[model samples]
Target: MTPPETQGQGSNAATPGASPAVSLCVSTLQHRPDFLRAASALRQGTGGFLLQARDRRDDSPATRVGFTASKKIGNAVARNRAKRRLREIARAVLPGMARPGWDYVLVAKPGVTTIRDFALLLADLQGALARIHKP
Candidate 1:
C-alpha cells in the first residue's frame, strides 16, 4: 500500500531515506460489539491513557483500533481533543507495536490525555502496549 497521506506530524509514511518497515493495514473498530470484545481482553493503563487489546480470531488481515473519551473528561471540544490526540499517537505508534488480527481500544483519561507532552504520551502508549503483549 502506498503510504497514507500525512495531515501533519503523525504521517503514516516512513521518513525519506529510510527503508520502510512492514506496512500496517489498520482498520477502525466502529461497531459496539468490537469495542466490547476489546473491553473484555487484556488491558494496560499508563499515565496518559488506558489501552485494551483483544485477539480478533478472524480472517481479516488488519488490526483494528477504537478511541473513546468519557463525558466526565470534559465538554465536546475537550473530549474531541483528547480523542484526536489518542488517534495521532496510535497512528504513529501502532504500526510498530500492534499485531495483526487484534482489536485495540484507547480510552482517554481526564487531565493527561490532552495536556501531556506528546513524546511522553507516545512513550506511555508504547510502554502500555509492551506490557499488554508480553507473554
Candidate 2:
C-alpha cells in the first residue's frame, strides 16, 4: 500500500474512469485463487507512479484491484481481520479515489486488519493511496 499521506491525492478524479468510485471490490480470498496467485506475482507496475496527476492514464475506463495477506499476520482470525479492514478501505475510498482499468493490490500490513478502528484504518489507507497514486 502507498503511504497514507498520498491517498488523498488519488481520492479525486477517481471517478468511473480514473476514480475509485467505479473500481471493483473483492473480499473473499477463496473466491478467486487464480486471481490471488496472479496478484501475488504482481510487481509494482508503474510503482504507483502511473496514477500521478500528470502521467495518469487518461484513456483508461476502469481499475482492477487485488489484495493479499500472508500467514504471518496470524491464524485465520488475524488474516480475516486484516482483509476485513482493507475491505472497508476499498469500499470507502476506492469508490472515489481510483480510475477505471486500474488493478490495485492491497497487501496486508502486519497487524493491520487486527486494528479495531476500521474507520481510521480506512482513512489511513485512503490517504496512502492518495500519496502513492500521485502525479
Candidate 3:
C-alpha cells in the first residue's frame, strides 16, 4: 500500500465537520451618492476622526469606506495629512469590525486628526465602529 496521505492532514485543512475560516474584505466607496447615503446613518466621534456608518440594505459581501477632509482643517498640506491619517486608521480597523453591506465615512477633524497618536487613532476607529454596530 502507498504511504498514508498526509497532504490533507495539516492544520490549515478543514477537518471533517469543521467550518473553514472566512476572510474579511473591504472596499472603498467612490460615487457621490454613496457618500450622501452614508451621511444619514450613525455618527460617532473620537479625538482623531468622526465616523459615519450606514447599512446598505443590499446583498453585497464587502464593506465600503470613504475619507474626507474639509478646507477648515487647513491648507493643502494639512488637509492631505489629515486624510492620510484617516485612511491609515480606517485600513487598520475596518476589516474585522465592519460588517458587509455597510458604508463608512471617516471625516477628519482639525487640530486633532493629524496630531493624535497613531495607536490612539487606531483605537478610536475601533471604538467608534463598536458603538455604531451595537444592537
Best by lDDT: 1
- Candidate 1 residue runs with Cα over 4 Å from true position: 1-23
lDDT of 3 by residue, 22-128 (tens): 33767778899999888888899888889999988899888889999999899999999998888887777776788998889999998888888999999999889
After superposing candidate 3, which stretches have Cα over 4 Å from the reference? 1-23
Q: Candidate 2's residue-wise lDDT over 1-135, tens digit each? A: 866656446656345555545335323223465354435442332211111112224465645555666797789888887777666667777777765544566667565456546666666656666765657
Cα displacement (angstroms), candidate 3, residue 7, comes to 34
Deviation in angstroms for 97 in model 2?
0.7
Per-residue alpha-carbon lDDT of candidate 1 for residues 12-129, written as tens digits (9 for 90 to 100): 6556686665448988889998888789989999999999999888888799999999997899999999999999999889999998889999999998898999999899999998
| Whole-model lDDT, model 2 | 0.54
State the C-alpha lDDT per candidate.
Answer: 0.90, 0.54, 0.86
Report per-prediction Cα RMSD to one decimal: 9.3, 15.6, 8.4
Measure candidate 2: CA RMSD: 15.6
Who is ahead in lDDT, 2 or 3? Answer: 3
- What is the full ranking by lDDT, best candidate first? 1, 3, 2
Evaluated with TM-score, which candidate comes out highest?
1
TM-score head-to-head 1 vs 3, winner: 1
